[model samples]
Target: MSKGVIVGIDIGSTKICAVAGIMDEVGKVKILDIVEEPTQRGRVSNGTVVNLEFTAKDIDRILNVLSDKAEINIHNVIVNISGENVEGKAHQSFLTRDDSRSTIRKEEIERLAVDIRKSFRPTAGNIIIHTFPQEFIVDRAHVPDNPIGRFGITLGGNFFLISTPNDPHLALRRTIESVGVKVQNNHRFVPLKIVHTLFTPLADAMAVLSEIDKKLGVAVVNIGGDTTEIAIFQESGLRHISVIPFAGKSITNDLVKAFQILPDHAEKLKLIMGAIPPDEVGKNDIIKIPGVEGLPDKEIVAQNVSIIIEERVKEIASMVMAEIMHSGYDGQLISGVVLTGGTSNIAMIKEVFTKVTNGMNIRVGNTIRNIGQTAVAKIADPKYATVVGLVLSGFMPLDERVPEEVIWGDIPESQVSIGSYNNGFDTPNSKLNGKKEEPPQEEEQSGGGIFGWFKKKVSSAGKIDMGDDKNYTN
Candidate 1:
């Protein structure tokens, strides 16, 4: 068995959280430490870094806390990115073999994926983040999940391509690099890598979605502090993904504006009072809202709080339902909608979602199913789903032909130049130069393909192991 420590950073509009954990030879993850701090206002918005310098400082603080607690010098990390500018589109490509009798090879499948990626022309300020295959068609007669080694004269593939604005993408990388964390690599472009940037919803799906759920059709709704991300899966592939510029923070803002209360007080009321049903609250029940400075404590009816929360929660749910319908898989979600993220913790969220979707199966999603270890118990909340998934994605095996689906844009050679290095952080001469290297060539596997690399790493001797029972401070 082999083991190694990996760090995952989740940068959100409301908070910055860093998680370090150990992955065993068999892919079980044990949390070593988790550290988080409130993101300064204006530093991040809708999961995008708005203020580069302040965001960098926040990341540095979070990394320092994690490093101090884990008692390790962190060098590299997998980070997540999301925002309103992030979007997903459906695309397909076809390839024909010269000989009709020849069996389809993995390389040919990969070439088809490359063709699909090249066909996409992202807007000037945007770049493709991921391109995941939905299914493969061989010889116009058979449709298989994996077409490698199949006999065919022609092969075709349907893919889901995800893209994000370049400004936010570059800002996120710059912030991480400013903290001395390395964010450059092109190691085979495998889906399962310890250090790379990935879409937040995709990472969340990796951690929480099962193969059964994907095959049966399901939508993962991640409600973050500033955004609600939706990813729909069907036939064991990603079908649609989107970001709604509203979430828990939006609810808090509503409360603040409605009650004229401080943001902190509004948040406390939202969490403590809970989004209870209005009818459940007693007519006489009243909650006290602590006053600030010279202001006197204000008393409001519990029913009123419930009403305020219910309205916003319902609105968010309706928006999610709309996105699902737009995905064209409205009635195909056999597994229903799975709600996750910090906001999913809101009282009655599932109930609200069920009502909005007209009684579709609804449930709250957490990391308990995939994560093991008592240390992670405290962080097993829905809020940590994205970061937890980021860590878990490092251990999940990559599909054979999917490696070619990793579409990193043409990075300028100028960005490849490494500038001065100090304090474990290397400052790039320019932020725009963070280009990914070309994937290395490897012999295609007859059956296992690139997945064999994972098995070899897991079973290999002399694996790097984090020592036992080291000092870790809370």
Candidate 2:
């Protein structure tokens, strides 16, 4: 329970994980402990909170368990968030340097970089998360890196920008605030400060990808329960990113619809019994599944189930293939695809990807480099890559938008009212209250959710009652 210890909370579609650890002297993230709890399905879908109250409860439950295991009142933490709303696009930013300046001064280069960030105006209700300059052009020539001290009249940067809507971003912080770390001294609560907010795909890249693969051009496709994030990297930097709706959930739902089984059973059938290519399954095999209530046991052909799984897996891969092609790094990715997340553990998934991407040397990334706690080598497994990456922030902090320091957001670790207007969010803080807009739900996928987190009190007994969502309604 040292002051330097920072916790990482990863809220995903199917589960919530809280990890407490500190970087060891050897520059490795030492795992102190980890605690996980079910996300109760769609409470948090595609990494965005839908029912703020229920999501808060789930997060609070996990953190409380972590606080007890670590034997301390954990406070500040780094967070990873995602959603289908997360999108990235290639953009051009240019500046015409004046002749009077003579030389390209440091500030001039810096000004040009900031100006490009300003130029990217997302649609209303959206904000830029991070802007990465892929190449610096000086006088129509590409400047591999620093453009300073170089002589040029036209200074420009070709960038790939990442952005998401403000509503979900706000909802994430408010959800954290509502579940703020509980105090033990008295029956009171304080805002659980967020030290940093990161993109899930970026964090997964940090844990699952190596520098060599990056330089050789690699794609990270994290297939989680409700979403699959695609990140294409080359020259040791991000070139494009996207979040798609087809993922493990889509496959599970397909099984549910085709097999007439519950979600849990369908998921097990997918994981334990499913495989690529119907030929991998026996033609005459019969699998029996227990029926709900008092009905007779259901019988299904094994090859037919495998065929269904393979078809859905193909669907997910097709979408992923389209994204890689869209990135324009399609042919250049020598390292090919590095798949992460729970669904990546599927049998023969590599062959599926290899077939889809025309044999791109696909590999499943399951281990983290220089990771401590070797006894449980893959300490966190692929599912917790985001949180594990956060734990390694001491040494592997995310790269700044540019060489110069420009802090877009700095939310200090201080107590505040989650409900009242005095909350400490750097942005104008408020509960999206009466205007709980529900984003379009694709099939069963709703990218948007409710937000009514308040400065609810938690008793000294370590219990909180946030009450009903009706109280905050319009």
Candidate 3:
């Protein structure tokens, strides 16, 4: 492990949460400590930084507590960027080669990525957050995967580029740097700031998704105070992302408008009453609200509250479903939807999503392989997933590759099962009825292909051990 400790700060409209975590010797993520602070009214709208000064102060307070608990100097944090200003669009780039016989190198592909950024600015003042590769085209033909070592005349790449307005991008950096968190790259001569800014939907995917889930396809629906973030992943890549303005705050506002109550009171009712489908609650059950200035208390039916909550929840769910379908990956999501954020915890909120999305496999988000099952409170809450992702950022890049079928495929039955005992044979499937073994053919009788005369040879003899470097073979 190059680095032991990582800190992630999740800056949301409702609150700011910081998490300090370390990858232990056994390779499990261990949460060191955590600290949280409210964003204060009007400082942040949704996930955007409206007031840089106060946002910096809120982050500073949280950093102070986390730094003390972790006993480490707090600088260089993994943070996220979000809000309506952020958007993603398709981008393509071509690296033309004069001679088709020239072999492509890794450096050339990296150069292509660097050169591609210059073309992403559709409008002025837009900064690219990420350039996710959708596919690589070699000589106008599809290659199996990343074609760094191939020979081709034209290398074209299809990408999904995420970008934000310069104002928000600069504001986010300024807020973090104001609180003493500066991102620096000393190993490389060129200064790089791209490594520090992770888009929110990608962070949500990192915290809750697994390799199979992403490879098979999955969607992350993050329901927050002021916005709902939806991201679709297919073939181990982020295919789409959408931010909806309707969220928990909308439900609170509806309650305030219908009952003529205070915003705080409405928020309280939404949280305590629980947002469930209207039919789940009985109509006769009523919760009395104490009126202000010694006025008469008002009686409110539980079913009415359910009705208001369910309506807004359904609208958000409908938009979420629409974004997934619009991505054109609706049928490919075998892992289905994984829900996160504070609003996702509402009672039976998933019930509404299931019904709206036509019964996809929707479940509340949890760390798939990012963290082990633990007693830490933050580990269990979906609200802290973004911060946890920030902490996990040090271990792996956003682009996680699925294993190729050719290199690692299914194995045959072992010795106990009377088929393939080891990798001594070259058959994809070696099956024999009962315990009898099949005799070798005429070609196998000759000492050819390194396996002399049907004799078995051990191609690999090693066990997987993370701590021992010699255990691995090339």
Best candidate (score: TM-score)? 1
Of 1 and 2, which scores higher on TM-score?
1
Report the C-alpha lDDT of model 1 over 341-454, residue by residue, as the tens digit. 888987778888999999999988867777777365667687888888877766664233455224332222332242321111111223434544344345344333224423
Question: Can you tell me which runs of candidate 1 are displaced by over 4 Å?
Answer: 1-3, 142-144, 181-194, 275-280, 398-401, 404-474
Each candidate's root-mean-square deviation in Å? 14.8, 11.7, 20.7
- Give stretches of model 2 more than 4 Å off: 1-3, 96-110, 146-154, 183-189, 275-280, 373-380, 393-395, 400-474
Off by over 4 Å in 3: 98-103, 181-195, 275-280, 373-375, 400-474
Instruction: Itemize residue pairs with steric clashes in candidate 1.
Output: 415-433
Estimate, for each residue in 1-474, the C-alpha lDDT of model 2 and write its tens digit. 224677888888877888887667876667777888877865886668788888788778788788777766777787886897776666666777877357776666556545555555454566666656666777778765656678877877666666678877877787786676766953667778876567787778777777788778998888898888888888766787877776888888888999899999888788776544455678898888899999888898888787777777777887788777766778999899988888887786788888988888898875556366532445547777777776655345454335413223222122122223222112434344454435543342323311110111111112212112212212
TM-scores of all candidate predictions against the true structure: 0.81, 0.79, 0.77
User: Clash totals for all models, in order?
Assistant: 1, 0, 0
Please report, in order, the local distance difference test score of every candidate based on alpha carbons: 0.71, 0.69, 0.68
Residues 94-126, candidate 3: write the lDDT tens digits.
767766787876545554454454444433445
- TM-score preference between candidates 2 and 3, better one: 2
